[model samples]
Target chain A: MTLNLEPLWLTLKLASLTTFVLLVIGTPIAWWLSQTRSRMKQVVATLVALPLVLPPTVLGFYLLLLLGPAGPIGKLTEALGLGTLPFTFPGLVVGSVIYSLPFLVQPAHNAFEAIGSRPLEVAATLRASPLDRFFSVALPLALPGLLSGGILAFAHTVGEFGVILMIGGNIPGETKVLSIAIYDHVESLEWTQAHWLAGGMVLFAFLVVLSMNLLGQRMRQIGQD
Target chain B: MIELDVAFRLDRGNFTLDVAFTAPGLGITGLFGRSGCGKTSILRCVAGLERAAGHCRLDGETWQDDAKGIFLKTHRRPIGYVFQEASLFAHLSVRDNLKYGMRRVPASEHQIAFDEVVDLLGIRQHLERAPSGLSGGERQRVSIARALLTSPRLLLMDEPLSALDHASKQDILPYLERLHDTLRIPVLYVSHAPDEVARLADRIVLMRDGQVQAIGSATEILSRLDLPLAQDTEASALIEGRVQSHDDNYDLTRVAIPGGTLTVGRLDQATESRIRLRIHARDVSIAIRKPETSSILNVLPARIVEMQEIDRSHLLVKLCTAGEPHPPLLARITRYSRDRLKLEPGQEVFAQVKAVALMD
Candidate 1:
């Protein structure tokens, strides 16, 4: 089967960028979820998990509105003189982060929960301030959970299609990911290109998931036990 | 003097913990109660771990006062807390865990040194190992050492030995004894075992149903006939004794207690080491007259200071020996024995203490 490497590279780039961005933003949110007792915890938890249950196309549809030239997010970004984001690589990265929120949050929250408040309390008794405790105690204990969460989010984004299809659209070297490439090849009666792209994604997904599962298992074993 | 006058009402799903108490300023003041009795919660309240409803003040330093708007957070409060579980950071080595507290506590405020705590706990050997590899007793010792290194004004421990087995408890107990005897900082020890209280507590605050039942010296409260703990066959009088002499040939040791000289089974040790001795209540036997021939070596003439029924079967006799003003110790005998001897609270008799067991 004839192979097309451009779309495969784009998929890797998009998924990698998305996972990195989510980690930076998701860490504090996940920490808050584990530590907070406020009523807003439930509200925020439900909001973060919405992407897990809501149809990917539905999520993408609203995201399209929010990121379109005339929409709130798009208008604000344009005011800062950045060009339109719809159907661009950056657009897919944003969509990927939103769509994979739970993939990152649930693992991060679970890790934080497993660490418990006892260690943190001990840290405080040791004369550590809240910030110091979080950095010195919580972060090291939560490292495994964070790594697993990041891996899961990255793998999930690699396979993402419907969300990227609606919001990212098919722009070669921009938003034309592996799944889109395979779809486009089949539609143009190019069976060879379709099979090549599908094979690449399968192999990539297998390796990524295999390593993630191994890491997740290793992390779970290392935590608290 | 450290004064703790605090109140808190928390309703978990099935349990309720609301406590208030004040302890003596010096020595180890034990907060003792059975399981699920809010002992840990009270310690937490003192550490600022849980915010209670009332006021908490120590040595005139205010920790929390809802009415006056003074509520210091747990970190802000100068307290050292050791929990039931070691809860040491698993990622850090034993040395790092010890240092975790030292670096955060400014050099100006904390008087304790890293080397002092390491030596006190005898944790220098395990300094490089992660917390997970250490035994239960080892982890607890590290937990205690970590808290002490913080240099807090007061130390609070919540059933630190509960998770440990008998051997482990024994291993950690000496370290605790040293910490209590040598350190100037007072400790609030939460425990339910009367044995532990008798051994360690100078003052005991007995808790039942979330309230302080009685607050007094261990010797006084432990001798009571009604408290749940006072009913044990192991019921003993905790007497502070100084080693007077030891006769290796006679196989006997002499101890000078507050009231009089006590001759007990010989121990392989020299004089000058202070020992805590437990003379079990059931071990005592009173005679109207001084008996001539007996295996017992202790028979001091004691007057019946008080007598009370312990149960349907037994009578508790409080005896005052003929030396100065030491507090009286109790002896449990049958009502028949009490009636047959025509015993009264002030009746003078030779109080024959059966035997004395030396405790650390």
Candidate 2:
């Protein structure tokens, strides 16, 4: 049986885009969560982490409604001449980002937390502005955390099945991610095709996780030295 | 001269920091106090790192005025603060750490040269190494170099030697002295070590329970019998003098004080260089008359300025050299000696200094 490469390409694309978006959006939120003492910090943190435990379809159902024609985001997109997001590649990206939010944020938050406030204060005393301190001191110090978080988010997005199915459906090039394509092959008793894709995913995931652990160890060694 | 007027009140849980003082910004003005006495808080206030309900003016420039709603943030204030810990940027090399402050200010405002600071701190060898690779002393030296490169209007050092071991402290102290002697910017040094304060500070501001207990020249405050520091067993006086001459054969040095010369152990400093002598009260013995043939090296005619009973058994005597306006010296003698010699406040006597310890 000829293996369809479209799902693998789509999965990789979705994972890369989702990881990028998550990093861009999760950084400041994680920083704020780590630094803030306000009561609202807990509320926001819980909301971000809710995706980690909630069923993928439950979150996908809500996101689907939000991206539908009657939804506010859908209405805004229509007004902007971009049209609705359902069943689109962009919809898959958004759904994957939300589905993988905690994976990206928790590690980054822990990284920022472990840094404490002394370095920032030291930077301030050295005449660094707030933005300068964040980029120069905070960012470099929290790099290990950001790396781990980005990797986890990327891996999670590559394997995401339920959320993509509910939001973007199994459209071939648009949102037929690896997991969903695997499911289709299993249902059709295409064991050879299923074995190819499923085994590939397991190996890829194991390698990603092993490399993350190795990178973490290497980062710790560098930090200690 | 830079002048400072700091009045602040910060209510922390069980402790309330209420402090007000004014000092001329010159050679090191030591904020001498016990731990948790709000000394660091005051330094932090001057740096604009801590916001308190009061006003602070440095060199006539207003840094914080709660009533006027003027509070400059820490980065906006031109200050070089050296914390107790080195607090170096772990990610940056020593050279980058030094340059961090340099890049912030304009080139025209750079009063301290990068090379000069590195030389003064003796960190030229470690310029390319990361902070984590440095020893405690090296890290602090680099941190100090970084602060100096800022060319701050005021240098605030909060127990800069507190975190180091004895060897590291010894290693870093000369560089601190170099900064003290060369830098024109006023330094506010916070420390609880009396010797550290005495050796470095030109002035001392004593704090207790968040209150300014006393403020005066280091010599005056360290010698005052009425202050708690003077009541200690190691109570001594700080006498500023210059290296008069060196006797290399005998390893002896003659230091000229206000009215007389004191022969101390040989020092490595150049002739005419100003040095501070710490004459412990217990090491000095009051004589009724000048001795003719005695092994005691230093004996100068001193007039009794004041005498107080330290305890039932001991007498604390304050004396000044007979004809010069030098710092007063302290002599702790037994009450029996005071009574037998009939020592009075107006009497002229001789102070036989058994030993004079060199400070810096």
Candidate 3:
């Protein structure tokens, strides 16, 4: 039987979009967390990491309630001329971003924190403006951490199942991602299709984790050298 | 004229820094003190890197005035700082590191060109290499070159040579000496090494316990027998002079000091080149009568200026060559000799110097 590739495309799209958005928003948050001495830093960090420990369905449930017609975000979106996002692709993307946030932010935060204050201070004495220093010194040195964060976030988003189910249900091209598709195959007793998809996921997850370990090892070598 | 006037008070827990001093803008002004005495704090204040309650003015420009509530940030100030550890940007090549500051200044404001700075620092071969691969001395050279590329109005060096080994320090000393000879940028060098201060400083600010103990010309301050620098057993005086002539036959060189000429071992420098001679106190002996025959080759008529007791058995005497505008010299002798020769201030005597140390 010819397999429908719509779910795979949707999963890739969702993963790519979520990874991009998380990187854009997570970078500054991670940087702030790394540099701040304020008491509020731990509070903010805990909130970000809540997704890692909290059930994805719990986050998805809250997001579903918040994105429903009666909720504030839904009301605001409706007022802004956009309809409510309940079981749509946009709702799935929003759920994926929240679920995968900690994966992206923690690595970036650690990377930025690994760089102490000396490089920035040296840059300052050399007449580098604050923005210049961030772009030139901070970003280049923390590149490995940022890459790890992005890869983990992408992989985590692709493997997401419960969040998408709770927020988006399984609406074919609009919200049906790979994991939900695989679940649907197994529920219908399609054992062959389930095995094919499950095996693909296992291989993909293994490669991604291997690459992360390799990147970490390479960074450590560079640091020692 | 004074180029920098700094008065600051920084309170960081138990370590409090209260200092105020004025130093000339030309040549190197050394901030000499022991460790943790706030020498680096003063330098950080001058560089505008650290904010404390104080007033710092550079060449009549107010960098920070606590009374006026004005403090210029480090980037806005025209200053170049060399950190103790040679904190070069690891990501950038040597060329890019040097260009970081150069690009900040407009072309018209560039006093030293890139080629000139590279040649001066001898980092032309290291341009494309990353800082991680360079030796300690090479890294420091690049750091200095990077600071110079900024065309800074003031250069602040915080023990730039302290982190290196003796060989690396020796490797960088000539380049530093060349920098001193070529650049007009006023250098505020922080160092705990007395040799560095004596060799490079035009003026010295003696610091102890976060306070300015003394500030004056290098020769005047270093020769003060009352200060800790001169009170030590290794205390010596810096005598500025020029090479009068080099006698190849006797393998000796005669240096022209303010009062008279000094004959020393052979020197490689040509005649008329300036030289600094270090005269240790212990090498000098005072005699009431001039000795006609003695193994000592250098002896000059000197009048005692001041005599102070160094210890129970020994005395330190300040002497001036018996001539107009005489430079000061130190003679460390026994207290018994003082009573036997009836040595007193203003008494004409001969100072027999056994040996003079030439500073390379």
- Each candidate's DockQ: 0.80, 0.75, 0.74
Look at candidate 3 and tell me the lDDT of residue B194.
83
What order do candidates take by DockQ, descending? 1, 2, 3
DockQ of candidate 3 is 0.74
Screening candidate 1 with a backbone cut-off below 3 angstroms (N, C-alpha, C), the clashing residue pairs are B7-B53, B304-B345
Model 3 chain B: lowest-lDDT 10 consecutive positions:
B320-329
Q: Which ten residues in a row have the lowest lDDT in candidate 1 chain A?
A: A216-225
Q: What tens digits encode model 3's per-residue C-alpha lDDT throughout B1-360?
A: 538888999999988999998888789999999999999999988877788898999889999999999999888899999999988887889999999889988899999989999999999999999988999999999999999999998999999999999999989988998898898879999999887887788899999988889999888887787887777777678788899998889999999887778999998888999987889888999988879889998888899989889889998998988655677888899999999999999999999999998765
lDDT of 3 at B110: 92
lDDT per residue for candidate 1 within A14-120, as digits (tens), equals: 88898999999999999999999999999999999999899999999999999999899999989999876888888888889999999999999998998888888
Across all models, the iRMS values in order are 1.1, 1.0, 1.0
- Docking band of candidate 2: medium
State every prediction's TM-score relative to the real structure: 0.94, 0.95, 0.93
Model 3 residue runs over 4 Å out of place are B232-234, B282-295, B303-318, B331-360
Q: Residue by residue across A64-136, what tens digits does model 3's lDDT show?
A: 8899999999999999988989899988888888899999999999999898888988888877888898888
Name the best candidate (by DockQ).
1
- The backbone clash count of each candidate, in order, is 2, 0, 0
- Report residue B211 deviation for candidate 1 (angstroms): 1.8
lDDT of 2 by residue, A43-121 (tens): 9999999998999999999998989999999999999999999899999998988899999999999999989988888
TM-score of chain A of 3: 0.98
